[model samples]
Target: MRSPLRTLVPLALWLLCLPALAQDYVPSRDAWSHASPSEAGFDPARLAAAVDWARANGEQAPADLRDALMASFGPREPDYRILGPVGTRGPANGMILRGGRIVAEWGDTARPEMTFSVAKSTLSVVAGLAYDDGLLPEPDQRVSMQVSGPWFEGAHNGAITWTHLLHQTSDWSGALWDIHDWADRPDGDDPANRVLHAPGTHYKYNDVRVNLLALALLELQREPAPQVFKRRVMDPIGASSTWRWEGYENSWITLDGLRMQSVSGGGHFGGGMVINTRDLARLGLLMQRDGEWNGQRLLSSDWIARALVPSRVKSDYGYLWWLNTGRTAIPAAPERAFWAAGFGGNHVYIDREHDLVIVTRWTPDLAGVVTRVLEALEQP
Candidate 1:
């Protein structure tokens, strides 16, 4: 007959080791779990300085933002444009999470706003989900085999692989969502209508090509990309319901008799991810956790590892995510840290080494903000 306290102790230890019980912080569906900087191993005074710095460097759309863009680019790519004048911007705001607990936030972190190129990272994850589901054969598999006749039927486009598309090295030339690949950000002095490099050998950040990848994903999933992300990624990770990914005005495509709009990769021509900073922080947290939330694995750590591996062509870029190889992307941040960066200073940064996640929207000084924020942590 064991002592009553001894028997109870074993049961208590078992409960403590369970995954859900092991978690120190997990949010309710509608709200985040909060923690003080000191509680989360951050220097309270230094964290305050970081928050104050954000207040002084928040983002606002310039009255001449469009005028400046049009002036610089000569003319708008009408087909790629999202239609109408720009919407009023939300405040320059963000949230910081340490060990999945909210450490601090500034601005209106709940208000949704355009997140530009960060949408590309969202697209990258969707691609991961498809690959995980076996809908895609492999990174090297030719997309032509999956997509039917028309765009990918020709030799130049048919040569493109899923890896090529993910790396932005496909150099797949095409007019998608009505904008020609060569015309989106045409090289002024050396414009090449035809793709000069073979597929997988060159890199180009063409929004049209990104849209093409979206279409390909939509086809591969046999459903909308949003549906896949919602069912597989967001719902499990406890992300907010206020997020939306938008496509261009004319990006609709008919697949299997159902018409679907292909979402844009960025807010460049307009119409991309519109998400609040809190939700953005949630996403960063998930990635920081290697696509796990609480006890469940939303994505395999293997996929996350492969996705962050630098492309052969672009050392500073991973699958739609910006890597800090050689500390080029963020000089102050660790080389292992990576970010999903967007125009207007929108960003979702992940640093597993420091167990930190950061989301910044409408921020102006990315490098300056990152440098100051990283200073709050007790260095390893």
Candidate 2:
């Protein structure tokens, strides 16, 4: 007995809610295992044409660079296999850009894939945008001023601020435990969570602090974090691809919810953001360009400078980014280069002076693949 428009509205909402319905259709591995490239969206004729254009435009690499680069291709890197166990079972893809043009690219760089904690770097950008747009309260503002919920009352949480959260110096303890334990607790107001050290005095990679930051952003914006991201950051940069912020399974929880599952538009805490390699490259390029893209300044140069400056925790910890002090195996040239690295060998290495950005998406390795990649980057 419902009106026709009313009936259609529910049906539309139901269709929108279905996961498979909204996703881009991709061929299953089994279906394309034996198929030709033409059958897999890479038509032979088109590919040949593209190759001809490349040759005509002199886009082919120099003989020596080609050989050196190709040597690292395929599944032959035993050290990488050992270092990244989860990564070897799948494709390892990467892209390299110099002077705003792709110099070398390999593997399936266009596919939507997981980037683990690389999401944190993206979250940092979001915070910068929020600050620029006036959505976020001032960075020095006390946490107690913004969030009045039971979590910040009369404890170290009250003393926390956006600056402290960004630097991983919120002084909160009991955050080192696995995420599942925190998710299962019912009382959001537990006093056992106290300051282990004064804010800005120490550094610990605490997921809870970042998760709380995500919550604060959501509360300030009054919308899901991803939408805010799209409007302020991603779309402005011309990345139109769909990405997701994964969460725990069942029962939609806050960004900090324990049992969340991977959802399309969610918060930016621990389990958020699944983007394709191409978009990831775009993001790196944006950062490398000092927040400018296609002739527009998305973020102020001053802001980027501040974000890349090291914090008190480490000589390398920036606003959420990681600066390379040449301490890691990766000999970051010019010593001004920085990176946003994640578990399982995901990395976005940005060198502003060199006008270079390198993005790698690889399986988790047990061997020293990370060290080898760093060595490769240091190549003369």
Candidate 3:
């Protein structure tokens, strides 16, 4: 017969296990909580303030332009919702301007949020600043000369130039799409890393290739990439927001580690930047002005020209920037346009012909948000 103590102990263990099996189930609100306009950084009052300023300063839009701007926020006969489709639905936010004035703006301008691959286009501005400052070598200089490490040991690897990296034509073989698979391999730096389909042969979008550009910048400056970015680009543009470049660490692991690593700024899209919409608009405006702001030349006009011009890979892609017009499945307006597009619906649309800019943000979705927004702009 079992001792009384043993019988009691088993009974206690069973009681404890019951609670473990019946633990309360609480659903996660991470994504759902973000759907609110306040959470996304929107305040109707702030928009009113901007409108008031525009009115007082003679910067307001005409009635027709205002109607066009409002139509962009919803799906109508012409599909004019400005926010597009957001949060697996449609675009969450949008902005519109004409003649260098804020015609229509919406969503949270104060929310610091993720802009996805759009950050890549912004990175080009940082590189431009470095070039203008003489901190970085000419685009034609070989990577081997700029960086010192085992990675640059071979002739071909060493011969890879900044221009090659910018154009996504670097002879590096690893695909940006496959970075996660290769990142954790025991031999991350194997010779296979240098494999490529002939340099400049094709246009393949790769995050590691872009990250290497960041690494190259780090090697040149001996400082963190974010620091260089702030000093060179953010501060000059008067972007008052907190942003950080994502990276690996022990204490905290990102929800999507691999996806984060592939981005130009190492992922953590929100951490990569948390700027208000207005600041983003200002940056777009500065680019529209050819890298000059407030009469100060932030970057050489020549550099801006190079960035806006299409590359060999596709008519749509320029050094990190996305050219809107030319040859693409997306319909192009007669006016040449370029954009900085992020995952989700984050966008900085620049129209050179009309001197206009449209900025927007939205939750993650792969729908034809880009095409829709462009169509909205084409409205008479």
> Tens digits of per-residue lDDT for model 3 on 19-106?
3222121112121011222222224355345433322332112223224334432332122221211112122555555434454655
Per-candidate TM-score against the hidden true structure: 0.88, 0.64, 0.63
Rate residue 36 of model 3 by lDDT.
23
Encode model 2's per-residue lDDT on 1-380: one tens digit a residue. Answer: 75979956764564344342122222221221122323222334543443233223321222232232234322332121111101111356666554445545566676665565677777787778777777654787886776656555566667877888777777554331133213222123553443257877887664456666666666565556677678766776667456666543331444444432222111212235667766787788788778877677788786678777778777778888887665543452546777787654567878654445667765333113223323333222
TM-score ranking from best to worst? Answer: 1, 2, 3
Off by over 4 Å in 3: 1-91, 174-195, 250-271, 325-330, 363-380
Kindly provide the TM-score of model 2 when superposed on the true structure, using C-alpha atoms. Answer: 0.64
Residue clash pairs of candidate 1: none
> Best-fitting candidate, measured by lDDT?
1
Local distance difference test, per candidate? 0.78, 0.55, 0.53
Stronger candidate by TM-score (1 vs 2): 1
Model 1: lDDT to the true structure: 0.78
